[model samples]
Target: MTDIQLNMDGEPGWEPFDAPALVGASLRFVSGDRTGNRFRMRYFRNASGELVARVWFGPETEGPPGHAHGGSIAAVLDEVLGLAAWAAGYPIVVGNLNIHFRHLLPLQTVVQVDSEVVAAAGRKISVRGRIVLGDRIFAEADCLCITLPEEQRRQLG
Candidate 1:
C-alpha cells in the first residue's frame, strides 16, 4: 500500500479540535489507470461544518440529449447529504434517498450539492439537500441515514 497523509497533507491544522477526526487516511482525487473520462467529486467542509461536493456532468452521464443524468444527480445529492450527516459526529450510511428533478440540468455546467441535517430519530437521521446550478435550483433531495458504529465507519473513513 502507498503512504498518504491522514490530514490535509502539509496544509496545517485542517483538523480542528471541535471537529471529529476523519479517518479516511486519504481522499481520492483521480481514478487509477482509466483511459476515457470519469467523474470526480470536489469537496470541502463549509463554515457550518457541512460537506459540500460538486461535479461537472460528463458526456456519458447524459439523460436527455445534452442534459445531465438524473441518476447521477441523485447519487451526488446522496453523497453530499451522507457526508454532511457524518461530519456532524454521526457516521451513517445512506438508507434511502428521495430526489426530485425540477429541471433539465445541462452538461459541462458545475452542479453544487449543499446538504444539512434536519432531524435525528434514534438510529435514523433525516437529511435534506439541494442541487444548484448557480442561483437556479436543479433538484432537491431527502435522505434517511442509518447510524453506523464508529469502529465500522472509521475503517473506510
Candidate 2:
C-alpha cells in the first residue's frame, strides 16, 4: 500500500470537517481505503455552511479506458449528499438518489463535490450537488433523505 497525496487545494474560508466524527465508520465504504487506489475524500464546509468535498478518483475506479465508472460516481454522490444532511444536523438515510451524467470523469483526477440541503419538511430532507473539476461538471445529483426514526438511529449505533 502506498500513500497518495490528495491533490486538492482548500478554498479560502472553507472549514475542514471530519466526516467520521459526524457519521462514524458508516462512511468507510466510500471514504475508507486510506492506502488503496480507490476513492480518497476530504470533507469541508464552505463559508455558507454547505457541504463540500474534494475527492480523488483513483485508478481503481476506472470503468472506461481512462475514466471512472458511472456506478462509482453515483456511490460517491450518495455518500456525500446523505452526509450533507447529517452535517446540517439531520440524522438521515438516503431514500432516493437521482443523477445526471454530463461528462465522463477522468481517472486519477481530483474533483469537487458541492452540496447543500435544499429543503426539509418533517422527516424528509432534500439535497442537491454536483461533481466538477473547475467549470466542467462531471455529474449532477439530487438526493432525498429520510430522517432516521429514533429506534432506527439507535439500532445503527
* lDDT score of residue 41 within candidate 2: 89
| Model 2 lDDT, residue 123, Cα | 99
lDDT assessment of candidate 1: 0.66
Which pairs clash (backbone N, Cα, C closer than 3 Å) in model 1? 24-157
What's the C-alpha lDDT at position 91 in model 2?
A: 97
Residue 112 lDDT, candidate 1, scale 0-100: 66
Please, what are the lDDT tens digits per residue for candidate 1 over residues 1-157? 2121121122122222222245252223221212223344556666566666555566766889988878867766766677677777677888999998888888756566778899998989999999886689999999999998768766665
Report how far residue 83 has shifted in candidate 2, in Å.
0.3
RMSD after Cα superposition, model 1: 7.4
lDDT of 2 by residue, 1-157 (tens): 2233535656899999889999889888989765578998889999999989989998889999899999999999999999999999999989999999999999988899999899999999999999999899999999999999999888877
Instruction: Give the backbone clash total of model 1.
Output: 1
Error of 1 at 85 (Å): 1.3
Give the 10-residue window scoring lowest on summed lDDT in candidate 1: 2-11
Give candidate 1's error at residue 13 in angstroms: 16
Per-candidate TM-score against the hidden true structure:
0.72, 0.94
Ten-residue segment with the worst summed lDDT in candidate 2?
Answer: 1-10
Best by lDDT: 2
